[model samples]
Target: MINYLHREQILPAPIEKVWAYFCDPKNLNEITPPDMKFEIVSGGDVKMYEGQVVEYRVEFVRGLRSLWLTEIAHVRENEYFVDEQRVGPYRFWYHEHSFESVPAGVKMTDHVTYAAPFGLIGDVVNAVWIRQRLNGIFDFRYQKIVELFGSVK
Candidate 1:
């Protein structure tokens, strides 16, 4: 299993504001890396009520394009939300996102647990470069959030 943690601070923003950014499916492409060419193929509804399913098409490294689908497993308004993969690149994917109102701004956290499709071979590939790619994607997202929301401090 691949477990990852991501955290960010959005300055002067309430938990609701941060949550809005996350729930809006259209904004996903804004936060994702441009190089990845991410796009939502279906489920464009911005309001993520419980049991919503989101489907996306993403171009990987300019060569492969894949369809990814996830279901909104749980949601607690501005506090937290969880999405589990129904079908996608990974054999298993569970991502939980949390938001907290801090003194300075809003603290956002992402915890992802996933397993690649190809078992041992996929694990090896993940160790070599997939992990780094994932980090890069998050880095791009962080920068985009900072651009959209400005510094929290």
Candidate 2:
């Protein structure tokens, strides 16, 4: 399996504020890069209760489109949420999002474990570019958070 980790801190904001923003389905497109053209096709509920499933369609570079369906496995209000892939671009995808209250603000952590469809070939591709692409997604998300919340410091 391939793993990716991302961490960010938003200053002067409580965990609830950050959690609310992230859990809102409408904000998914806002944080995604315009190049990807990510859009939620179903399950646009703003509140993430357990067992919620969200379906999304993404247009990759050159109009390559893929459908992703994810289900919320676990949730702790203002604390953490876990989403596992029911169907998506990858063979396996599980993301854990956690929020911790800090003196300055909220520290958010994203842990993603995924695997491609093909076996060895997929591993090689992930090692080379897929991992980097995942990181880029997080980088875009970080900037979006800052834009939505304003500069922390």
Which has the greatest TM-score? Answer: 1
| Model 1, global lDDT | 0.81
Candidate 2: minimum summed lDDT over ten consecutive residues — where? 3-12
Q: How well does each candidate superpose onto the true structure, as a TM-score?
A: 0.93, 0.92
Report the number of the highest-lDDT candidate: 2
Candidate 2 to truth, TM = 0.92
lDDT of each residue in 12-106, candidate 2, tens digit only = 68777888887887888888999998889989766787899999998754579898899999999988899999987788988998888988788
Model 1, residue 17: displacement in angstroms?
Answer: 1.8
